[model samples]
Target: MRRIVPVLALGAGLSLALSGCFVNPLESITENLVEEGVEELIEGQTGVDIDVNGSGISLPDSWPSELPVPSEGTLQYSASIGETFSAQYEVSGRGTFDDLVSKLEAAGFENTGEIEYGGLTSTALETERWQVSIVYIDGEDSTPAALQYSIVDKDAP
Candidate 1:
């Protein structure tokens, strides 16, 4: 019984110590970028507008690139339940949803599956602590456009 008590206590301590390392995914990304000076990159790349909806963060004008001209897409929003902030990306093009999925997968996003949003089809992907959604649409000039959003949990795995 004496030996067992020490073993249990040691296990408990280790578990508590490890739990402290787990951070929210979104927070982790923000922290990492801030540390690496990527926050400036984001600000310089585009302006962002944040809208908090249930289970999602909406950005109406997440990307404003005139030359690239986002094909004909809207903002992509992603967030975890408890995350204070979320991540987003924009894609533009007119193609099958699979094409967007492939693009994200190639970009290191793990393909999860497909979902439907307001009658439009979308592909979903998830990393250890982040989630992404992608969709494509027809541009104003009939060009192809795609939109994507990557939601990173502050406490990511």
Candidate 2:
């Protein structure tokens, strides 16, 4: 847990930085080099393999098969640590949160908790192997209708 947070931070930072990082095709090469350098530095410091596919973010290669790929949003950010993953997205239209909930239920997660406070909503769901939470983070520090989500491996230690 102590070592994994920086990898998550790098991934989140990349979510915001990607647009500015890739200004043009020619500069994309330099950006890739910079990205690699950052990955190496973070890996050296934390030992987590922090791979962030920015701009057009997608699920990590190791994304657990049981998890649903979110269908309602542009991929804003994703990071994987072994089998666990965290992702954020800028959603579209209405019912995006419900869409996420329905998919997780279809994947066998049971709704374990829900809360609405301070004008934000969040839901938590879980399975024998995993637990997930999705929360609205659309005001102030986030994009409109954005969702922050994560799936934790129950057996991770």
lDDT values, one for every candidate: 0.42, 0.73
CA lDDT, candidate 2, residue 94? 37
Per model, how many backbone clashes are there? 21, 0
What TM-score, computed on C-alpha atoms, does each candidate reach?
Answer: 0.33, 0.74
Worst 10 residues of 1 by lDDT: 62-71
| Candidate 2 residue spans exceeding 4 A from truth | 1-32, 51-53, 139-142
- Compared with the true structure, what per-residue lDDT tens digits does model 2 show for residues 1-157? 6745776667654654464645688888877877777667655765555554465556777778767866778776666666567887777633778888898998788999999887478999998989899886545544467788888898888
Alpha carbon lDDT at 142, candidate 2:
47
Model 2 C-alpha lDDT versus the unseen true structure: 0.73
